[model samples]
Target: MNKKTIITILIALVAMAGQAQKHLPAFQYSKEPAVLSGQIIGNNQQITESVHVRYSLKYTSGMGDALRQTSAAVDADGRFTLSLPTGTTVDCHVAVGECRFICYVVPGQTVTFTLDLNKLETQGLANALTFSGQLSDFNHDLVYATEQGIDPETIYRDIEAKRNMGQLANELPEKSEQGYFHYLDSTYQRVNELIDNDREIGQAYREFAKAVNRYEWGAMMPFCGQSIQYAGIDTDEAYDAFEARLKQRLEVYMKDDPWANPVLCYVMWSMPETFVDSYVSHPVKLPTDYQQCHLASKFLEQMGAQRFLLTEVQKDSVLTFLPELAQDVLDYNERMERELSFVSEQGMSRVCTLPDNADDILATILKPYNGKPVLLDLWETTCGPCRLAFKDMHDKKKDLADRIHFVNIASENSDLATWQRLIPNYIGDHYRLTKQQLQSLHSQLPCNTSGVPIWVLINADGTIHHAFTGWRNVDDMMKEINQVLQ
Candidate 1:
């Protein structure tokens, strides 16, 4: 053979060898969709898991529908099969990391994942994303998590769980923030689904959302307060009709549904008049028609919800009569203060409860650190900034050791033994509190201690001089501390 022919044969051999070495299957789903099979391995039978696979479309990018499939018990040997979407690429991942599996399917396909129960529990609280994606961008993340298909509703609901739990509240209006609106819109849409049977309810929610989004909290608050008054004046108005519709719908939806958060859409629907009526610049005295204006509040109160929150989200609602409410808030503080005093008597405790209120949380925390400025560092086992901040604080202690009191606080959820081991001979006051105790304490001492690496200048005067909100703002903290010292 000629040299050229020999070279051609060599090229063929190289190409064939590359094909053989490919780790993924060569089949294309767009043409020949088939079942992907897998088995879950575990050390024992009790370790078995039900795997859920979320599939996404490849070419459409992440916008394509994401579908999910589940498998029966892997044979005692851990085996199962899942059918893939035909004529398209799909990717699948387990929900909540419920169980791990190695997917064997067409290569070059897009995929996404759903949170398994554990993951769902971990993130669904306070409205967080249950799953993370390997992709870089939001779209890619969505695609990677559910390349086959996904229930936008489920994703939104999971987000709602996080939001209600306060985990997703800080994510502003952006793509990473899509989960917020996604859940909001999805919630409104679901309520609308129920509204199909009850237009009155639909109209009310739509109006609530409209007012909330366009108008400030002031307008909606009083309007609802007045709605209650008007409700009493005219018991037969559409407002009453809508209220009935809303409650009926809620009875059906609240079960297995997280509704602590109202969708921006539904919130808009609740108060349309906000757009038409200007907010009161100053505290507007209730018109002589005050009783009339607040008929809705009375009605709702009668209905057993005005006290709940839907109607009283802002001060303007009942604050037309401020002295009373202010007194209540103050009294609540007094009660909390007493609690904090009790806590102060019992220093170095564990934080265990998620708070019922944001107010007075600081005083509660301060009880133990009373008279001594505490370097309250809320570090978790996995917090990175906290570790850095703790070390930095420790290093600085030599200078302000006498003036500032430092306490390394962790959640009560942490294993005390494990924490002791991690810190080893930890001399500083170590404290823990439930979600509740931490929150209540923080609210009173909102020096900006929103997240961990929190540094506070609690003076001997029983007044907080400054609070640093997040570890990211550590420099701000340094400045504040300097100001306090000066």
Candidate 2:
């Protein structure tokens, strides 16, 4: 090689090596552990005793395997220290006793902070505490920004209330779109200001949070947009415009950072739901055109989004549409198979039938209140709405404590620990069934759906009077309960 060319190559190699080192600063700490120490105080500003503290440090965005969890127990003086993985941005959840606080972090740098239990108790444990450390200020600001951002529940509740009052304007669809977009714009402005002005935030977390925030904003828009209804926005021309604009915005986010967010994957998987207003009543096939088919195929390949479809119905729809993505379906089945095998190996035998021993499992479960009416709840620990519904009717259940037998049967997939923690909050009898047993029981039900939380009301005569999925229609549910009581 020429001397000049060799010199040029050496210079280029040196520059590349410098850039590579910048990206891998965390690897240096692999040999030397990173420490996160903190102190906890109660409402009286005194050190809390015997507090159990824990936190899960996970990649800001990735598969389940990227999780690194650490925890520590606070002494009588309320001081504790824990080790954490350094380098990448992690979504950190810190717990003190029963109160938990969430914050983001890049762990190599020393972190020291004090949490005020007084503020946590009054404000509620969600994103209320701030942090102080090398990158913690920016992380704290991001958490604050998240708190200030528009709440989806507030928006939905307003819409429902407006609808009920018949005071919704015909232009609400347009207004709702504006409201959501404005929120996104405001959040972006705040984040950008923090990144530009905060010298210590560092480039790695800056880039990660920017991409994540943008994608999440875009992901939330469709739901907000579709919820807008006063005058119909479902007309073909209107919906097509809305859909096109959404796709255009998503394309921008995808171009900037494809792997940094799961929002794109969610949008792709939810494509079928977009047609609910227009084509739901009329039977239609997926990937209805070449353009859609191409988009769906590309997104599936890019996001590996097949794991999002946990239900049989969702899997069936995808398999029917894009035959080429059959491997994703197979992978999910294999995962379920492994889970089943592991459960069995743990001595968790799944009995499918109520044993011929009238002392049979199902029979024994229901035999206590044989003549009285029973309201059966089929749910899982992961089901948020189920928990909400149960809590919402806690008072009502207490009032009816003498009249109805509230029996809750948790799905096999629920962890025993989680079930134990949550079951006590509900006033009822609780039983847990394995996935095999749950499926077998479901076969006897008259409904065709396979989602929870499913509620079934049994008449005083011990016959099933009503059954349904979801916990939204409390009034309808109450009507059935009253009918069964009568």
User: Which number leads on TM-score?
Assistant: 2
The TM-score values for the models, in the order shown, are 0.27, 0.42
List where candidate 1 sits over 4 angstroms from the true fold: 1-372, 425-427, 447-450, 473-476
In terms of lDDT, which candidate is strongest?
2
| Candidate 1 TM-score versus the reference | 0.27
State the lDDT of candidate 1 residue by residue for 11-46, as single tens digits. 999877544322222223333444555444334534
Q: Model 2 over residues 24-113: C-alpha lDDT tens digits?
A: 122121223456677776643444554333343221111222235566777766778776753333446566666645544444566666
